[model samples]
Target: MLKKILFALIMSVFFIGIVSGCSESSDKEEGKGSGKQTVKIGYFPNLTHSATIIALEKGFFEEEFGKDVTIETKTVANGGLFMEAMATKAIDVGTTGPGPLLNFYVKNKEYHLISGAVNGGAVLVSAGSSKISDLKDLDGKKVAIPVIGSTQDVMLRKALKDVGLKPTTNGGSVELFASAPADTAALFVQKQVDAAATQEPWGYVLENQAKGKLLLNWDEFAWGKDSPNTVVAASQNFLDKKGFSASYLKAHKKAVDFIQNNPEESQELVIKHLKELTGKELSKEEVAAAFSRLEVTTNVNEEVIQEMADISKEAGYIPSADIKGLIDLSTLEEVSK
Candidate 1:
């Protein structure tokens, strides 16, 4: 009788262990089945990121991702900060300038450009009273760019070098000051800076409100016309997840379409969101003038991007970069189909 009881107790203990193991396994599988619970998107507040702003304001991302997935949007001031968010996995996807995006991609081959957000909208502006008339006049004058390694910065550096001038940082004649677009506009208005190479609608603000002059519209510059200013990109981790990339691209395409089909309404949306993000409300004329300078589209021109990469490399902003792998338009194409 004693032996029989001992054996039965041992059998019961063994069965309990098996059941516990099975339960743990089932829990893990359930966790995997749940997939990603939240999707974090990062973007700049500039008009170049209008697609991201409009999509977030319109609930297009939420509607596409459904209620199960929480969509969180983070507004970054510059492309460099946006890339930092991506590096830390704080943002699953982002919209940034081609300059910062290419620089990041060269260092960390973990992100890929999924689509283009906006093209053009950048300008080289000088104070109305300034003697600077063109890039040639930029010699020995103080010029402001949004950020040191920004798209505008890279373009300005190359343009100045081509004009036989150089940025102060790069041992040249032009004195470069890296300031926020708004601050640049204010400085230009106050006559604190000689010239500002900045993006629109801040360029518009500087020209109209700040009494600045447009020295060079972006179209006249290399890598300007239909160039990729802002691009939508996703991290490798996000791309590894099922269904998330597709949903994101779908919403992005929709936002681009909305921008094209509803111009006035889209401008209003951009204005409203810009106010919410930057506390700066632009007038209808200002917004319209800004839009006239920018080409908002979803098409990613690989050749233009490659040219940008080459420029960035030549400027020593990045090491050798193979941009072919940096671009993955398959997802965008799939969404279009």
Candidate 2:
């Protein structure tokens, strides 16, 4: 009788353990099957990221993700910060310049470029009294950029080198300062910096509000008309989740299409979103001017991006960049179809 009772208690304990294990396993499977119900998106508030801004403002992301999923958007100051956010998984996807994205990809292989966000909209601006009419004149002057190794910085450095100059950090005559575009605009307004290499609406603001001059339009820069200014990147883990990535890309495509096909409406949306993000009201004319300098699209130019990587390496921004596996346009292509 004692032995039977002991055996019965052992079996009861075993059954409980088995049931608990099954429950835990079921929970994990359910979690995996359900996937992430929320996605964190990171983007800059500048006109260069107009597609993302429009998507957020116009309900494109919500429309794509439906009411079940929650979308959280973060306005990052620069690509470097965006990359950091991605590193900690704080953001699932982000829009950033190819320069910083490439640099990040080289250091950490977890992020992938899924689509293009914007092209052009970057400019070299100088104080009105600086008389820096050309890149050559940038010699012996302090110039500000959004960041040290950003798209604008890489372009400015390469352009300066083409003009037979280099950044002071590179043992050249030109001094490079890194600051936010808004701050750069203020510095330009105060004549604290001789020039600023920046992306738009800030460029427009400097020209119109700060009385600055456009030293070099983006088209005339080293990368010329074909360069990609911003791209949509996602972590491999996020992409591996499946449904959300495709949905995000579809919404991205829609935003680009809306920008191209519905210029007037898109401009209004861009202005409204920009104002909300920056807390500074922008006029229709200013927004239009900013749009004129940019091409809102989803075309990822691989050759141009590769060239940018080369430029970044040559400029000593990155020791070397292996862009292989960095770009995965399969999702974008599938969404387009």
Candidate 3:
């Protein structure tokens, strides 16, 4: 009788262990749908990233991922650090432009473009020098840009080459310096740089506040009208294994829709978030002007991205980049449907 009771207790323990294992597996599946996976996002706190503010303020990401979703926002100094965090899986999602994204891909880092964030946010400005009006005037001139591989850099280089110039080479014509958009404006105001290419509201700040001259509005530059500026990118490993991209895209699309449908209200949200994120705010008109000049869409179309890549190459940021394969449009396509 003693032996039989001991055997029965052993069987009961075994049965409970199996049941607990099954329960744990079931919980993991439920947790994903329940928003257990933390979503980490990275971006710069700037007027150029107004879409991100719009999305966060409107709770678009939360709605798509369910009420339990947590969105952690990290503000890095520049796009290079932002992309670096994304590459290391320290960030689950990031919003940056094509130039750095392509550079990462060329280095064999795995990521996917889930959606478009903004467009037409770049411009080239001269300090107080009228001679820097056109690319020809850039000869031997010291110009500042945010970063070497940033979208602004790619476009600026392409625009320079269009006017028959190259960078970091004698007779190349222009000297490009690395500086933050806001800091670059200070350089312009101090006359330290002949010109600098950057995105708004820094451009607006320089022109409106500092008495600096606008050399080239991005639209008037090489690519013509705005090319996609910010893009929503995700890790390829995360997308393939977790299958969370569809949900993420749903959130991103919702963000674009919210921005479009509620411009004034959305502007207020962006302003509020920017103030909260950066401890400052721009005037209503400045925010409105920035919004009017920006295109917030998520269409990762091949042709447009390729144009950006071509621009990157011309700038010598990359020898070449395979942009078509870099985009995982199917994620957005499915999310849209």
Predicted model with the maximum TM-score: 2
Residues 1-337 of candidate 3 have per-residue lDDT tens digits of 9999999999999999999888888877655535476778777788667766766777776777665666677877677788788877778786877777777776665876778888777778787754556668887888888988788877777778778888874347677888888787667667788887888888777788767787887577556565767888777766774546777777667778888898888888888888887788878988887776677887655676777777666566677756656887777777677
lDDT of 3 at 97: 73
Ranking by TM-score: 2, 1, 3
TM-score of each: 0.87, 0.88, 0.85
What overall lDDT goes with each candidate model? 0.84, 0.85, 0.75
Q: List the lowest-lDDT window of 10 residues for candidate 1.
A: 27-36
Alpha-carbon shift of residue 161 in model 3 (angstroms): 1.6
- Model 2 lDDT tens row, 61-84: 999988767799888888999999
Model 2 regions more than 4 Å off: 1-36
Off by over 4 Å in 1: 1-36
What lDDT does model 1 reach? Answer: 0.84
Flag the better candidate by lDDT, 1 or 2: 2
lDDT for position 13 in model 2: 100
Q: What is the lDDT of residue 65 in candidate 3?
A: 68
The per-residue C-alpha lDDT of model 2 at residue 331 equals 82
lDDT of 1 at 169: 62
Count clashing pairs, candidate 1: 0
